[model samples]
Target: MTESLNSALGTISSVVWGPFVLIPLLLGTGLYLTIRLGGLQFRTLGRAMRHAFFDGDEEGNAGDISNYQALTTALAATVGTGNIVGVATAISVGGPGALFWIWVTGLLGMASKYTEAYLGVRYRVVDDKGNQLGGPQIYLKRGIPGGFGAALAFLFALFASIAAFGIGNLTQGNSVAAGMKDTFGVDPWITGVIMFVFTGATLLGGIQAIGKITSAFVPLMIVIYVVGGLVVLFLLADRLPAAIALIFTDAFTGTAAQGGFVGATIMLAVRFGVARGIFSNESGMGSAAIAAAAAKTSHPVRQGLVSMTQTFIDTLIVVSITGLTIVASGVWDQGADTAATMTSAAFTTALPGQWGGTIVSVSLIFFAFSTIIGWAYYGERSLVSLVGQWSSLPYRLLFTVVVFLSAITEIETAWLFSDIANGLMALPNLIGLLIMSGLVARETRAYLKFDPKLKKPKLSVEEFTAAQMPNWK
Candidate 1:
């Protein structure tokens, strides 16, 4: 029965994430937003980086955390198993061309990220406890207007709440467990218990706590992984040119059977590449918008810019390093047993014995654990939107339980199921982004006109919202 269910999920995942469905919708929505926004993500990335890493909170800004904290929190959720195992899986199943498609999602999806983040903050509301509420749940309903919007909002919330367990919970825990077992021979059940405790402790403090923890460690973890990957790349410098060519060539033409890599069609490459890319950075999934909505900024555009940097960091830099290292190290064509350990194996091949694997195992542990904390907040918020604030604790507790359960289990099925849920979660949010692209573009233009460099805006957020978005909820 389990095998049967896994097969069914694989088929459904293919259809949901295939060329005809989410591929076009995701890419088209992103392309449309990029044009509508006049490539704001490209033009403002430097300033966005400054805001995300250097800027402090605006005085009197209505938010629970600084923009930097929010950015890191979102990064915590994103820069995890996807960057490690997901990239490897993409290359293993889809070929190196998958990395090229991943790049496409990162570049184009930046616009989608900006639009969703802008709308998330634009339509955000203050809950009864004074916590901020946002993301597709708030934006789709309030931004769209009428029953259709409400339905979309509900579906987004439902999918997000469930996706939290799959992508955010199971896949993350399973990866950490798998990496540890592969590298250190640690038992999965032991890892599960320890992770359960750590995740639950972090969840008890809520988003504010998660933000503080992620902010402090997320950058450090990323730096460690990037530096380790760079060492591997340097060792494999001779293979760099050929690897780059293969990625581009295979992107258009399918990869033929080679070594342990059975083979992949052009369609498979595109599908897995896009799927893993979306899984890695989550540019269009709208999950990161939930974190962006909590940022302290004077304008939605400011927060949106900072928020979009999450994708740039996750995919453009981090995912690139992992994928390049895997391809260049010549471990990408290894069989399924290497999928979870591909990055580690690549690093091990370049560095002295045990050191490379140790770094990767430690990084995976931190990455996956941080993701669990970050996504717990997303799940909590989704439940709050569906039920109320009353569901927060219960949801957190349940999420912790699932982290343990997922760690001790096999995750091939989990990955496929999570991909489907992620696509479903993105569907309503993507529609909302496309439908509201004009409004997002207009608001962004209006804001940039007043403060192009992210300096002090001429108008206060209240004044700007009241004057420009008169009917804004």
Candidate 2:
């Protein structure tokens, strides 16, 4: 039964993430959003960075978490194994040139992420008890019209909930356990039990718990990984230029099999690069929107702009550094099948002794932990959307169990489950983004036109809620 199930999942995954559909859909939607937003991702990058870091919540802000906490929570989910393992996989299968396409994905992904954040916040609602509720579900209902919106919203919630089990819970646990086992020779089951306990303890406290922990953990882990990568880059400074040239040339001309590399066509480079890049940044996935909606901001567009920086930090900065270090160290072809170990080898080679390998292993543990922390919230919110607040406790418990199982189980099947679930989740969410793209453009333009000095909202939260209440037009 297990073998058959794995076979079915593999077939489904290939179909779901096929080069003809999912890739083109992701890339095209991002490009469309970039044009729709008039390239605000590039133009307002400075403002976005300021808002992400320096801006504080409005006095008596009406939300669960501050904007920074929300952004960090979202970042925690995004800046996970995808940065380390996913980058190595992309380069190994697609060659060094895959880095260029991945960069392209990030650049365009900024617009899609921005729009996802914007719509999430714009349609968000605060309960009488002050609980915040929103995401692709709310926006699809508020921004899109009629039955189509309602169905798509529900589909998104369903897929997100399912996807969370694999992408957020099981896959992460497996990665964490694998990293720990590889580094310390510990039993994977022991690591699994520890993660089960830790993640459950954190999940039991709810969104506030997630927000605070991720806020602290996310930045620290990112710094650790980035500083380690930078050390490797500095050590291989002379090889950096050649590594870069190889990436660009391979992107278009194809990479010839050299060393352990099996060669990759240009098509393979674009496919894996775009796929892994999406997995890394999660720009159009709509998961970030769930966090963005919880931010304490008077204007939806503010949080939207602020949240877009996640892609910049996750893909452009963190993932890029990892990719560069792997390339510069000339380790891309080594350990071809074991991408994570391949990445670790690069760092180990560049830094003296076993310190680099240790760092990568430690970083993975933290990254996977934080990703689970963030995804716990997403899963909770998804259940809440489906079955209301009553579902939160049961969902968290179930999520924790899956995390434990994921750690102890073989990870090969976990990868297929995660891919299929992710593709399904992205499908409905991306459709919604494209359908309501006009709203994103209109809302963004209106927000940008507002005077920076006039931060006061014309309508209070209550007034704003009253004005934008859902109506089927």
Candidate 3:
């Protein structure tokens, strides 16, 4: 029954994420947002980076977490196997050409990400206790008009909660167990138990705990992975240009079957590349907004600018490094490489020893572990949005239990199931973004222009709503 269900999910997953619908909807949303924002992501790249990396913590801020912490937490959720395994899979299945489309998707996604973060802050609910809760859920209902908003918000929360389990807990826990067992020969159950303990310990501390750990965890992990990947790229500097040329050329002309690749058309390259790219950076999914909404900052645009860096770093940098390393290592065409295998091979081949595989294994564990914790928080938010604040503990308990179970048992079907859920979550989010693009644009313009009255402190959710959408209540 489980096997049959998995097969059914795989088919449905393909339909849900098919190039005909999902790709265009995603890319089209990004394109629409870019036009609405007037290429704001590109223009404000420096400001966004400054806010994301170098800016000191905001004092007397209104939100829950620091801007940097929120960005890191979001990064923690996004920068997992998707960067390593997912990139390798895309290149392997879709060919080198896929990388180009992936790049395009990430580039367009920057605008979409910015809009999401903007709305996250703009529509955030600050309870009497000053707890900020926001995402597509709040904005979908609050930002979009009428009953459609409520329906869409509920739909988004439903899918997001479901996604939190598959993509968040089970898949991440499974990957950690797989990586640990492969590298250190530990039992999966042992790994599962240890992880569950660690997760339980941290969950007791709540978002602040998550923010602190992820802020520290995300930067170090990314730097370590990038530096290691750079060494491999430097080793293969001679082939870098050719590898890149093939990617560009084949993006349009299609890649012929070489080695075990079995070739790929432009359509296949676009489909897998875009899907995996979205999966990697999560630009259009609105999951990042849940984290961004909690950022401690006065200006929605300020936090929005900071949140934009998540996409730039996750895809343009981290995923690119992984993709390039594999291409440079000449491993994508060297027969079949499974989720973890191609990446492991690329690094091992570049380093010419077991060290590369060891690094991949170690990094994979850290990556997946961070994702497990980060998504646990996201799932908790989704549950709270659906039920109430009382659901937090139960959801956390459920998430950790799944963590243990997934560690002990493989969750192959959850991967495809998560894809379907992810696609569903994005639909409502993209719709909200479309409806609120004008408000985002207005807030951005008002903020950037240094509107004298608006510059001193952040607007409350209600004030923000009034200022941006004058017609709305």
Candidate 4:
């Protein structure tokens, strides 16, 4: 039965994620949004960064976290093994052209992520307990008509929550533990246990605590990883121009077999690039919107701008670093998993010796650990959205348990399950986004026209329902 189920899922995943579907779905939505929003993501990126860190609207808004913290939390989940492992996997399988596709996805995805965050904040409602609740589900059910929207929203949240456990937690935790064991010779079980304990402790403090931790951890780890890659690239400075040229050249012309490389077609490059790009940044997956909903801001566009930056940092900066390192070191030709370990090997070979391996291993541990923390909150919110606030306790317990279980699982199965759930989670959310895109455009236009320094628009009596407010301050 499990095998049959897996087979069925694999077929569905192929259909859903195929270029015919996913490419148009993702790129089309982003293009539509970019046109509708008048290229707001590009125009406001610097301003968004300013508001995100320095001049944030930290007036104790009724949300679980501040805008910066929320962005960091989402970034924590995003800038994970995907940046390290997923990029290597793409280049290894899809060839250099895959890196180009990843860049394209990130560029367009910035607009998609901005739209998701905008709608997330605009349609957000406060629960009976004054807690804020918003995401694709909220926008779909509330903004759209009839029982169909409600059903789809419910389904999206349910599957997305499950996916949170798979892609968001288990896959990440497993990678971290495995990396630690491979490099440091620590027992996988021991690493898992330690992760479980640390996750439990942080989650106990709730979203605020989660946000604080991610804010510190995400930026620091990204700097460390990027700097490490820069060092590698600098060591092989002469090859830098050649590596860049190869990404575009091999993208079209088939890469001839070199060393252990089996060569690749343009199709393979597109496939692996789009797949790993989605895995890394997750712009349209609707997961980041879960965290975006919690940002403390008066205008949805403010948070949306900040949200867009996550993709920029994830793909444009971090993943690019990984790609350059692998290409420069010529490690992609080595027939290997081309994920975390391969990237680690590139770093090790590029650097002096054990130092490169040590840096990557440590960085992966921190990046993946923070991802687990961030995704735990996403799961918690999704569970709360589905069941109730009371369900959070048992949900956390289950999440912690699964983190341990994931550590010992086969990497192939772990990645497969993560892929399936990620696809499932994306469907409903994308539907919601498509349906409510008009509203997203409307809200974005209004926010852009209205000055951020101005007082917030007064909520109409109809809009002042308890469902429209947030629980936290």
- Candidate 1 C-alpha lDDT tens digits along 1-473: 88999999998998999889999999898888999999888899998888777766665777999888999999999998999999999999999999999999899999999999998888899887999999999999998889999999999999999999998999999999999899889999999999989998989998889989999999999999988888888888999999999999999998988889999999989999999999999988999999988877777888899989999999999999999988888899996567988999888888997999999999999999988898889988988999998999999999999999988777798798889999999999999998999988887999888777777653565677678878644
Off by over 4 Å in 1: 457-466, 470-473
lDDT of each: 0.90, 0.84, 0.84, 0.80
lDDT by residue for model 2 (307-337), tens: 9999999999999998999998898976356
Give lDDT: candidate 2, residue 242.
Answer: 95
Best candidate (score: TM-score): 1
Question: Tens digits of per-residue lDDT for model 4 on 293-377?
Answer: 8877766767888889899899999999989888888887885454658888888877886878888888888888888888888
Local error of candidate 1 at 376, Å? 0.7
Write one digit per residue (lDDT tens) for candidate 3, span 1-473. Answer: 88888889988877877867789999999999898888987888877797677767666766788989999999999998888877887888888988998899999999999999988877888643457888998889988889999999999999998898877777777777777777678899999899889988888888899999998878998888989999989998998999999889988988899888888888889888888898889989999999999988766777788888899999999999998888888888864346657888888887965889888887888888888888888888877888888888888888888889988654567567777888999999988888888888876887677632223344463465456556531
Point out the worst 10-residue segment of candidate 2 by lDDT: 464-473
TM-score of each: 0.98, 0.94, 0.94, 0.92
Model 3 TM-score on a 0 to 1 scale = 0.94
RMSDs, each prediction?
1.4, 2.6, 2.9, 3.5
Ordered by TM-score, highest first, the candidates read 1, 2, 3, 4
